[model samples]
Target: MPAQPSPAQSAQTQLERGNGPEPSTLDAHRCQEVACGNVLRDLYEGLVTEDAQGRLVPGMAQRWTVSADGRTWRFVLRPGLRWSNGEALDAGQIVASFRRAFAPATAAPFGELFDALDQAQAVQAGRVAPERLGVSAPDPRTVEFRLNRSASLPALLTLPIAFPVYLPAVRRHGAQHTRPGQLVSNGAYTLAAWTPQANLQLRRNPRFHDAAAVAIERVRFHVTEDAAAELQRFAAGDLHITEVVPPQPLVSLRRRFGAQLRLSPYLGAFWLGLNTTRAPFRDAPCAAGATRCDDRALALRRALAMAVDRDKLTRYVTGLGETPAYGTVPPGIAGYTPAQAAWSDLPQAQREAHARALYRYAGYSARNPLTLELRYNTSTPHRRLALAVAAMWRQTLGVQVRLRNEEWKVFVQNRKQRAITQAFRGGWIGDLADARNFLAAFGNDGPLNWTGYDDAGYRERLARADAAATDAARNAWLRAAEQRLLNDHAAIPLYFYTSKHLVSERVRGFQPNALDRHASRWLSLSP
Candidate 1:
């Protein structure tokens, strides 16, 4: 094992080397908060990329070919690859890693991506033998994957970051990778030293497939979760890159570092979710009923949606860097050309009236009102938004709303357990640039489907998209699925996310991905 440097020592080393100071990596929270794709881009190489228009382009594997039947995909592994551990890279490891991902009890979060593989679900469910798994490596250099359906299989692997293919030594030790000795990265960089909750140090991997092209020699990540503290540190010129800045700090930084202030629209959406399996939401007729109670509830939701005012929320919470969303799909997503203006153009009165009519058609009256509970993350912004929406519901529909705010982790737990109050918060990052990423969140059986909305018609359309062979045809189904959600009011779009950052002018070659992961491989710090 390499001798690990203490956080202070490592950070000071970077400073002394005139590379500025690297961002904190305290919680391994890189993927959650910052543009982690940049970090991953530095660490791993992949097969394809999403162009500016969100189309897939070739990456590590160059170009691939699919069998005439679309059942088999062949990827010719790049020659002369090596793991950071000094082991020769081969196709066997790739196939082995993917097989493990599909193995029963593994339950890799990305299991769904392999659903197109023949009998993958059955194998994962233990209904079929693992031997029936649909991937094969003909030799140490050739990889082929068999799919149950024909579609853009390569696009699925086109995610910006590598999927962390496991080496035999690392996998043999089991699921823990806490120390430098245990970590064997195949990406552009390898863990040289790590101190949990303090600092993580990465060094250039000479054995990496593209080592010649990697520019950064060493990278350090410090864990700085406190937003205010982070901004203060950055302002003192102690840090090179930072995550989010509160409005106050943003104002100051904008004045001091005008050109350094960077903002990019995020390919994610924040929204509210109603659990449809329970109570008033369970019965289609009751949910659709035109009774005064249902009518009031419907009016209340629409009014709250209008009154919450995303622009105000962003200004207060996100420094007005984010674009307020009117639909589930992000603006630049394929098949989502904004035919009209923003949803803000839809008059509040008309929206409220439409809500009332929807309730009336299902069975409701304006004379009676419905009372419901709303849940939010304990963050001040979410709580404030909840309160504002509640007030609007009361004024517009004469309905009573109770607000419940829980810590962020607790809120996530309740949502997963379906113990949420009447309504709670939800959002999704774009896995792919297609509307399918957004639509996949609504299916009852999906991982992100917090709303418990299960419509046979919607599922039918989703399946069609999954089964689609051509890019154009699949995109059509994707568009239909999103339109279905909008017409049914399945989920309300709060806003499209935009990442705001203050980068030092000295940091060069740092390009941000819409998916919110920062890659350090493509970056270099100047003196």
Candidate 2:
């Protein structure tokens, strides 16, 4: 077991404040990838947290009081927490930083994610003054949000990136200077250095209220794309954490360092998206029909779901600690419940009948077969899963899928283009724990709704849920919307997610959450 840190340990006093270069901007709005996100996290803090179970919890705001109507929340900021540059952390900064994020020039991918904030949409549209943005820090120690509606307030606050407190110092520097050392942050750790494509170094932030509790004096994030290379590097003691490792290597790790090989799913679900606006998919009856394309897709989806052999996949693809997914929501989130319908093996005769009927409906002659293209990233485990799925589709649906492979970057771009591939694989980590996060992707105007399925009735239901007055009522509408999605076969649910990490024996007091925030506030290391 890793040696842990105590909450009251005297924080390292040798560190100097603002030892790095001065920043041109203190904002985190323009960062693009995971590496940039890790860099910016050090400088910002949010009001809520997505815990290990993918549940929302209080963050910088110790707690909040909500009105019965759910339109307002009074957040009490933690006292005496300061940014690394010595500015007293206050509510005014939160208001200013968020206002800047809404600016069109900032082009923040998360600009819409914060629409729940008071007057946020209005402010973004230039209809309101930035100061009237609904977030008021009446005093240096307090902040309050006047919301537009009632729904997942805390989860909305736990976005994966940005939402950090910004200082006036950053607005002057602007987006151009918002690099690693150019800014001061208010999180559990501070940026030590970032060597491109190598490692990102972070050390404890003395100004953080809970800094005394941080266990690791220095943390290093090594960027390696290959799973086999990552595990080999881990065994050689070259890295602290390696993610998305392949199954065969994971088995060897468990056999050798059983306790160190941690296993958990991230809060995400992989699925096959059908471009409902194009091709045979565009024809609603054809899409929903028992004909070849529709029928083959449904049978293939079901057969693939049932034949996945989740236990084997979990043991190999995920290294255990993962549950087979029957729905979009992962197992541990508050509203997630497994669907009553289970996918089990069908009799060979029935399977053949279904496949034949589907092919016939798809307009295929008796001798012809329905074929489509499938695309996935080239990760070793993903390769295995894709091959398994392809094989299952062939045997059960009698449909042959041509597998297309690409690097992670290219594959993502292809999906965005709605390219030639018929079915593409992907998942999203819940930015917050709302069912809306899942259902919204299917909504007509959902920003991330890559599937391009537009259902007017479903869209209305989503709007109603968003406008509901109570969490209970809102969640009920959201669940009904989910049922509609399931009944419609909008997308196939692959598996719920868990994050996996392997901590060294010397690293202590580490806590992993589905939101992927490293809560080192209470961590400390033994000498």
Q: 62-116 in candidate 2: lDDT tens per residue? A: 8888898787888788877688777787777776776676665554555556666
lDDT score of residue 104 within candidate 1: 71
Model 1 clashes, total count: 35
Please, what is the TM-score per model? 0.79, 0.78
Q: Quick one: best lDDT, which candidate? A: 1
Per-residue alpha-carbon lDDT of model 1 for 370-484, expressed as tens digits?
Answer: 6678887655445555776677566655557788876555665677666555678777777766677677657546445777777778888889988876777777777777766
Error of 2 at 243 (Å): 2.4
Score residue 482 of candidate 1 by CA lDDT: 71
What's the distance in Å from true for residue 134, model 2? 3.6
Instruction: Using TM-score, give the best candidate's number.
Output: 1
